[model samples]
Target chain A: MATTTVSPPAPGAAVPGRRRRTPLARREARWAWLFLAPWIVGFLAFQAGPMIASAWLSLTEYDVINPPEYTGLDNYRELMADPQVARSLGNTVYYTALHVPLVMLISLGLALLLKRVGRLQGFFRTVFYLPVMTPAVAVGILFLLLLNTQDGLINRGLALVGIDGPSWTTDPDWVMPGIVLMSLWSLGSTVIIYLAALQNVPRDLYEAASIDGAGAWARFRHVTLPMISGALFFTLVVNTIASLQMFTEVYTMYFGNRQTQTSFNSDAATFYVIHLFQEAFQFLHMGYASAMAWLLFLIIMGITLVQVKLSKRFVYYEGEDQ
Target chain B: MLFVAALVGAAVIFMLPFVWLISASLRPREYVFAPGFLPVPFAPENYAEAWRAVPLVTWLLNSLVVGVAAAAAVTLSSAWVAFGFAYFRFPGRNLLFGLVLATMMLPFAVTMIPTYLIWSELRLTDTQVPLWAGNLFGSAFYIFLLRQFLLSLPREYFEAARMDGASYPQLFWKLAFPLIRPALLVAFVFEFKASWTDLLKPLIYLRDEHLYTLPRGLKVVLDRFGYGGEQQWEVVLAGSVISTVPMIILFFLAQRHFIEGIATGGRKG
Candidate 1:
């Protein structure tokens, strides 16, 4: 890595030797702004603006047809008071806790398997990733069909093995397990990341480990893990954020019926975003949803900050290793 | 030999959906109950009947329009932003780039409802605009991906363009675009795949039967067929197979980039 010297700016001094903005530079800036205008407008109009609105809305008692009444902390207070909200939050954390680690593990395992397979590397990779290309709606439907109570293939297969299968979707206990299973099948994206990390690991480290008579597990622990810790951190952070915001599977499979508005059964799967959707769209509590959104933002930020802070303990950077 | 068997086993398991979809599609309506590997007395009309049952062709076209529009929009916008970040030094450039990265953390959940409201207020809902426009800002992920690729290119090429009085647009369009075709194609395939298989936004926004995408269209078929209990079992499976086949073909066609993007690289933040 290269480092540059840092210069201190003079205190309370207007620097006379600042780089002048040239005509070409100005022209480029204008073009840059023009090129970036859509994104700027979109961020302002959709993301940032709504987030601001949602924050404000979270404090008010607002329905769709009526103007929001200022009811400071009422929504938050209600959120604290609501058992269903608590259940939804608990369910979300449970789902994330169960899903993210499982996903990371399987994806890494699959990637390692592919790494071991030398000849048909490209072919096997493509086969595993085919599911990633399939849409969530299709995935949900496919799983729904697979998990059907009586005639579903999964149940039938279980029967063939002389074991009866539980009702997968309808039963609350099995429903989450079914969701976890579906998630495991779609670990293609993470597997790709692991493969990339694996490729980046220097061959010399493994060679050195072998020379030292280290077993495969020991080599992996000391060599592979450290080398790819950067990628692992990146993947872990991203997977955390994405898993926390999961919605499409439940929305497609459970709540596609528009009639059952704000019910907790589907909302039982309300991993954070679904709750925000429910508040903002279903109940027209835009302000409350906004607060929830901000809370979500803060929670994610806090968690990520803590992760980055604590990353030094486990994350082995090459420069640091030297 | 063991390795080959393991790979084969995994492939077969992964390929189960495609096999089940096709087999179920070909079975006679009454033969749905039969306990057999093959669909007894194959009903070829299942395909035709599924086609008639829903606006399958129209839905496919709608999906194409949305997919192409989104793919193009994301590709162009990402390239532009990526070029700026990769090549230029300006005030707040690093901060702006950091801001873009930070946006990646902002959950779609936070934005989904407000986006719908804004579109509804603008009366852009139910049109293809919402579908394509959802991607118009260019994704943080793609921008980052493109920027990574762009950084690896020789800087002197752009400097040479500048020395020759090549305008930014000219440099971007003529120089950058062609050189980064591989990265651009990767982004295109990604955006295309996401939009093509997307069901939620379309389901929420598009109510018109003619405007539905394939996933949404397939749902209509499933609902009409209404799970395994009803008689239209073969037709349901046939429609699913029909919906899945194009993607299967596209997967085979772009298998190189798709595999590269998913199996080994392009996903790290």
Candidate 2:
């Protein structure tokens, strides 16, 4: 050991003899920062640089072949009037509004049921998480098969039970709902998070609730809910953000004849990200798409802020002792 | 009795889609609309047919390359960066780590145009560079997970390593890296899955057929072969089956550590 760690300074050493920063500590800090160099560079180039560029790009009309021209918020103004933007908004909100809550309920319920199961805890966990591991594109393809109007497995099965199934993806009204169901199928990780949180809740609280003659639902509402509020809030925010960015699944699900479809279908299920993608890539409306991107960012931030504020009242954080 | 009902009910809901998918994949071409869940007169050659139809080998290889490379980059760089955050107490450490979390919320759309411009400017588009290039730097989520894992580690090793004159780099590569292998595995599997399944990146960057990854290849296959009278789904389902089965096996194998990673991530404020 070189002991090159010793610094030149004892000048700050007082009657209490507070130590100065050692060479080794200084070297460690330097090394730490060095280790983070790749990330620092990446964050600047990929994240911060693009963010600033996007704000600027949103205000202009830039075509990839030509240089960006200063248009003074024309893209923003256009976005305000764009019918496509409106359709994208309607579609996104439709998906998120149902998808988030549905996923939450399913995930939480699965966690609760799994907790009570005498055996097969691991089996249930594995089964639930399997879909999460499946690729979104594959799920989209499977849904295209399963959600077929007549011959598909879903309708075939439904007929056995004396029920009819809708043309899920093709039907304007059912499209978003179909996508939501597909996304909901992968709530495995969310359930795992909730299950972990559920396990941490004090058993005594449940016991106390039961002793007070509260039934299962009553105990769940009062005791269980508050205990895992943090996890609930976490899932809510994450699910909302993800659902708002819905694309690959919807895009692939309807990848059939894209030239004729999304454009003519009233944009019913063309999600915000998909719409933005088509604008930027397909139509070369880079500046307009960038504007939409900024708006999406604002919307996500606003939703998160609202969730934070809302959860402040509902989410329970216990003291360190408990 | 009610608990049993709930358990079975939840299990059915969770398992049905997969069961249907697996069943459909194995069903004979003509019997695709067969009445039951089981694939009667099972067609075992669906896998072989799908393997031959598309360049499943090429796409799988591409995806594997991207997945393995991205995972390697992610595991190492994220662990390195997270090591910095977790092990060292420095000025602005908390603020910087907060920046890491904050970056996660910035959607890809916000950054896509410029980043694409950057890649295109460097002539990297229509190639695979754009997909895995940025991954080499690491992601905020994995960084946070690795940092969380590192925070729990005992500092006793640092003293002994210091006595042995080991520098921070040596300590990181030699000591901390092995100890945090579990967290690294979690990050690796995550990045691998992400890279393999990622559609948006490949969609934006790779336009060449040969360059297409599995997801993109699968999409192309669906668009082309998806039309159908017969033999269509056998191929498509086979492709889907091929795409799905590996990840499922991986999930089962690394099940515990994988859940631990997710649980660890959610546990923090």
Candidate 3:
């Protein structure tokens, strides 16, 4: 169905406006509100209220112990001047740029392979998805072992091919790539998503295209790609947003316990959320961190909006009037 | 034949890290970095050592408690809310549902600090309460998921129940709840996984080592054994495997639901 999207549909679809209210409808409305009470309370306490608080906190200099002092626009201005902010944002963007496309491509490829597999489809899917089940902490630790410069499995594998591998965790240049490699292990979920979408593509379309003398690649490009473009666009946006907020894995591996490490290039791995986390928790720069959070919120919103705008051109919904 | 070969090859690559993890966990401290895939000098004592080196059992128990609490809370509440949106054709329902969907996109970073502050203000920071308590309000994603499932159910069933003079609560607890068990289970399992693998919340709120969940405890284990103290990589790998086993078991047990739920997610996307 065209409605098979993970992203929420546009807000006002098929909504009846200003209908004459029956007594039964009013009763149902009251009951609906009652049923929604818990969420409303939660939304107020956890989300909406906190968002307002965070916005105000961004304009103050509170460090939990002291009373918040007013400093309008100061934190925002500091964010503009902060070099670490720039570095962290750049690192996050770089990582996202590297990660999103690579993951989409690899997962799509795996999904295609899985689709071609006969009886062993489920078996292969399970094998691929096992890593996705692993906790971020475990994944991070496991990757540290795998990416070790000297005796790690990955480097050893490279050595088997007569190619020297860089010290993934230690070297500045290779650190982000190492994290990206680690992230790629968990692309199974994406693969599963693509597989589901791929399976949903009508066989008749492919048959028709083939009947028109279209080759395999041409059939795929014409029939399969457009049919699954909604899913692709969805994953692209979701993965990009998730990549921007890459914290737990990077933190666990590189920046979590820096006091223990003598020499690891953590700078390359210092993503934006990591920097915000450090400020809020480590340095207790509550005001500054709040500003960073708002900035990230704005960036994510802007990007998602741009994606939705762009998807109008690329994503084909079935049965939509062209 | 070539396609099968290609699938097998890719599957091997995908499975290699796990194979190596299992092998490394079973190896001696000195042999952890060994090149061979087989644990020739088999050292199952690493599990014992890892168990002793960290409060692995306690962390697992803590993880179970938090995961269950979070999962149960989110599942029940989200289902309740979803039922409201699904069964009730009320004014402003679409608007409210739209708002719920919008919250799914709001990054957790915006609320992280203030939410922490809210807990600390209530003097509930450092307790396990902060880990799962907020879930009592129902999460946006689960609400949407359950709502979709609820929407797919035939309205005739609910109407039939209502015509039998069933109250709203009866309509929910007796009719909708039982009918939506599959969706509820999906939401529960998904949330359980999320809570089990969550590191950030525990890292922020938890101070006492005894209170740490598996992921947070694993982080401590990594710091102690893997990086700092003794640099015993085997012990860390063993702990990692220990922490991962529950999830792997859950996956196998709920394989159908897990696959179906994910596919549903893909379909919805």
Candidate 4:
């Protein structure tokens, strides 16, 4: 690891006259601002600008065609009472809660399995991550057929085992679960991430634990889990954020076609972002939708804060003792 | 022995859905759901038929153009900014860089409605501009990626070049860009994938029939071909195959770079 100690401005790495004096320091600062002009400008316009506007827009009633009227927290107040907002947020929370655990387990398991394989590791790793590389829309459409209750391969496989497969996309109760399954199908990238983290875990730690009469589960618990907690935290945070705003799969499977908007199971797959999308774009309820976005934003921020606090308690960084 | 068997078995089962997808695409429309999971009575005509269902060729070309443009924008601009973050120190530099990292956690949905309004106000909505314009600005993830890669390079090279009177811009272009090509490629590929797979942005912004990307066109195909449950499912699957195969090919072509990016992203800050 290169010592990231700021290193005293790199000793005039980009220009001569190596000193930390005012004029030289000002020159470096000017150069940095010049070099970073594009990102800084774009960040202001695209990122910070949208954030501010979204906040203000949340307080007003505006359709695209008409000017915004000050609604004075009506949007947020309505959000408190709206059943759909509750449903969408509930669905999203259920998904994030379920998907994060499933992804962590599956990716960690696959990473562990891959670590043991020798010659065929590359082949198996490629196969596992292939779905992750595939577009989500394509994956969703394919799963729609694969999880079809009647002729789908999943149902067929279940039938051969003497079990009946429930409706995946149709059953309201099973809809989000089915989407969760679809989302987890592309666990390859997360698996690869875990695999990298696993590689960094010192082999001697495992050996030491084994020699100390720790069984396989005990070694994994004490040595492996502690070592990989940082990676686990990383994946958890990322997956939580993505799952909170999951739209592609849900939109692709249930509401891909506008003709199906009036279908029975429309609300079944109504995720937070998808609801926000329909409200903002389809109905042009930009202010209401902006309010929903902010509400979802607050929920995500809260969850992330809680996770960080909890991770601080449990995550064992290898070098923190130093 | 048990572990090996389980791993291989798991791989096969994990791949079953995709294998089934390809088989379903190749099977004759009538036999697409015929219990057997093989591409029997193969009909490649489904691809041709799906192609004709919409202006798929145009959409494909549009997707390619948008993807390449967005990838270039994301790569170059991100590398430029990362050079600044990696090499220089200024007042509030840490704070500004922190802001860049902070943006990564923001859901695009939070900014989507307002950005759309901004674009609409500029009369740029209902076009493909909304899909790729923001990407021209460096994204936080790619900026962080390139910055990490840049910091990993020995600083002495820039110092040597500076002794020869190379300007910061020249150092960035001539030295830093070439040195960090792999990370740049990673950002390029990521942006390309983002633009390629994007649905919501295109769905909201691209209302014209001819402006659809492959993903959006696949939806159009679904509407036209897979309207009722009884309609042809093979064609939709065929469209999906078309949408997916390029990414698979790209993955195979640059597997090392792609894997390295994923691994490095996990390892670094």
Candidate 5:
């Protein structure tokens, strides 16, 4: 109110008059800048400078022990030709392929069950979602103990059923699968997301399908699936991105046991990010690591763009002008 | 119905690791190898041994400090930034907000090297500053989350404050903040979980043993004791159980707010 009285615009003043506008505009800008100072400084010191430096560092062959030398395109070319990169990429793709679908299925099941339950839904939902709160590192260790070869509880349980469980981590064939199984521990968050989406689904659609003599599976297919496809697609995009960056489980499982010298069998579990980490810090190949980071950026960007493009065909929006 | 049975079955299977963790933690040294769901003669002392094995109390204190500090920093700064974007008109506002969100796409791998370089140059590698420094900038996720909440609030509140001669800071403190306390609390829980569970930053930054957080300390315990002998397994399991306890407790305490936060945050997406 004081500001309104102190600063009044003349009715006859020219629109965009420099005298009247500049000071007020400047005042607004100052306030905005004051509000934005922290984020901007952080972005510059932590984000922009680092991003540009990493981009430049990608072209130079710099180990920490020696000065960087310009080796234009060599890192890129080597990355193109490297079998290890190819192997890691292949392993990552395989891991994502297996893991994402399983995650979607399990989370969808949880969400649907919670939605259908008439009583104590809150209790069940909370119980099922506890894994999201568990520390991921601890979960990795717990899985390691459970999947260990000799005294593992998983093997013991299987033995009682007249089946023998393979060494989950050391065996090359089982390594990625073990990672996938371990990954299910954190499905709580995804289930929570799906549950939220399911809650938003219109009740009438299910009732309509029921009136048409639809069975549970038929109703789910005709009503539930179509209704939640937007959430489904959103989850897929986020999940794909998250799964592509899966490093913690592998690092903990493999590196945590590095003293044992238990060969990961085929490097099948060495994901792309893990390999990039090795090159950057462990091997001190900053330039090569930069190139690897850029390549991953491009790969993730490409996948995300493809998903965005493909979303139009599958994702349904309710009551939109379209 | 078969569906109920199937869901129950799946829930039990899903909860196996948690059950095993508690079981293994409670089992006596002799009964560890004896395969069963129940532990005979519960060794509650394992929790004590686990406590003494590492400076877990110190780790807990460190974790609480980092978590609370990060949560406070993120909520305050993000709410301030969100208020500006939601309430005020300014030049380059949209561009700046978009830039803020765009940075989210830049993964840590791209920034880790340069960040480490800057921190090492500043001689902050051995302190908790590196962990908390990232929070000062306002993470993209929290910023976006708060912005959505702030945007949905009635604009009349800000306009009324302006009519009452309130400056931006006063409006933020007295009016906008109280209304958005729920959102701020939700962001607190998120930021807390992120800081608490974070392993990589602390592993990279803190060099001294006493400075180690829970996850990093768990790694040390796992390496030192999880192997070499059968008795060590009990200690490690007990340690793992100890490390996981606070999170379980925190989840129970904050579960309602957390779920609501997730639901609300998810709705906009």
Candidate 6:
């Protein structure tokens, strides 16, 4: 876990002189740019250029086939009026709300359990992570089978305990929950993160807490939680962002060319990105879609900023100045 | 004792979908949803049927090529950029690196359509190039990962190589590259898995059925064979298993690297 075996000076450690550079230093700088040329080129082409184009396109109505016409914020106005936009955004927020906390809790619980395992840690970790490695499309299809109303394994399992399972795929009320269940299968990475953080917590702290006559719960609350809060916060933000963009799994299960299966409550799973995809690709409303994308980008940025601000109060980073 | 029992129970629950998938894949059409874990009336013909029903092999091959191209492109390029960040002391370097990391926070939704337009403008849409070509520049996350590894290496090696009159490329190719093979492999396998599982890019860029990757092909398979068309649950499960086995195998082989990479990522955060 201690990866930096021989730590060198930090990447941007201050050089001796501030005003001037040696010839050798200048030569090294030239070589650095040369080394970074590919990424620079890519940043311009794929990221920066596309971002500017997306912003400009958001203000203009230009389908791929049509000449550009300035829309003057009409797309944004329509977005505010569009019921599907609101519905999709609501669905995304709902999914994120349920998915993020559940994932963090389950993953943290699994990590705690793994920390207790003695010899078979690797074996259990592999089993837990196997589902994470499965392709989302495959997960979607597998879950569709598992969550079948009548004969799915999930319902069959529930029957054993005399609890009738809801029709997960077909019922509108249960569709998002089904997606959340599918999402839980891939919490293995989060679990591993928490485990790493848990292992990194100094053992002496727990011992000291016990010696101070603290119980297990107090020891965990006072010693464990604060020590691992950094990792917990990291997963919280990452999982929230990912959950907000839920797409491939939902699309594969409910919407993608499955005309026959469209009778189900597919609208319940129409996430924001899915709606944006339909607007851009399906309906050729590229301008409107770009507006939607910018909206999502703002929402994500705002949420992330809020999370980072909140983390300052909660997350404990060792060796940092208060 | 209770903890271990609970862990085993949770693991079983976590593994239930996979177990049911394999079992359903092996069952006859009539028993596709049988309650028991075992495939009582075993039937392996579902694999054969799934293969015949769609171009599963072609999709698998396309995925392999795309995955390899993407992995190689991103791994090399990100490593090169990371080496620059790690080894050099240049003005504006920190600002540039910060810019690279900022790109990670930009959701793909914002850039998806515009990037598609860029590809289409280049007249490269509907080909496999759009899928892997973007990786030629490199990814921010991989660049960050490899940079951490590069930063940890002893600088004396590079300085000594420089003193011996080795050119920067020679130093990187002959020394830095070999030293950071572990991190590079981690980057490669991670990108490969990403490309293999990627459905959106293929769905957006590729229109031809013959050019489909596994995930994209599986989507179509779901439509034509699964709940959408024939309701052939066994056949669909067989396809799911086929698409998943390679990744499972990859995980088992590179299990250590995968876990280590994730752990390092957490620490970095």
Q: Best TM-score goes to which candidate?
A: 6
User: What would the per-residue lDDT of candidate 6 be over residues A1-322, giving only the tens digit for each residue?
Assistant: 1234354553334477675765666777778899999999999999999999999999999789987689889999999999999999999999999999999999889999999998999999998999989999999999988898899888888999999999898788898898898899999999999999999999999899899999999998999999999999989989999888889999898886747545666788899999999899988899999999999999999999999999999998997742
Provide a comma-separated list of chain B TM-scores, one per candidate. 0.93, 0.93, 0.97, 0.96, 0.94, 0.98
Pairs of residues clashing in candidate 2: none
After superposition, the stretches of candidate 5 with alpha carbons farther than 4 Å from their true spots are A1-25, A210-215, A256-258, A262-266, B228-231
RMSD of 4: 2.4
DockQ, 0 to 1 scale, candidate 5: 0.50
Candidate with the larger lDDT of 1 and 6: 6
Model 4 lDDT per residue over B37-154, tens place: 7789989998898877668789889999989988898888889898988888666878888888899878788888878878988999878877777877788889888988898888
Tens-digit per-residue lDDT, A129-197, candidate 5: 777777777887788888887778888888889988998878888888888988876887778888888
| Chain A fold similarity by TM-score, each prediction | 0.85, 0.89, 0.92, 0.93, 0.88, 0.93
Candidate 1 lDDT by residue in tens digits, A139-247: 7767776777787777887898998898887777788777887777777778777888788788998999999999989999999888877777777787777777777
| After superposition, candidate 2 runs with Cα above 4 Å error | A1-26, A211-213, A259-266, A320-322, B228-231
- Candidate 4 residues A110-185, lDDT tens each? 9999999988889999999899888888988888888888988888998999999999878888888888888888
Per residue, candidate 1 scores C-alpha lDDT tens digits across B117-172 of 77888998878799888677777878877787777777777777777888888988
Model number with the top lDDT: 6
A320, model 1: CA deviation in Å?
A: 5.7
DockQ of each two-chain model: 0.41, 0.57, 0.63, 0.68, 0.50, 0.68
Residue B74 in candidate 3 has what lDDT? 93
Model 3: per-residue Cα lDDT over A172-245, one tens digit each:
88988999999999998899999999999989998899889999999889899999998999899999999999
Deviation of model 4 at B55, angstroms: 1.3
Considering only N, C-alpha and C atoms within 3 Å, which residue pairs clash in candidate 6? none
TM-score of each: 0.90, 0.93, 0.95, 0.96, 0.93, 0.96
By lDDT: ranked, best first: 6, 3, 4, 2, 5, 1
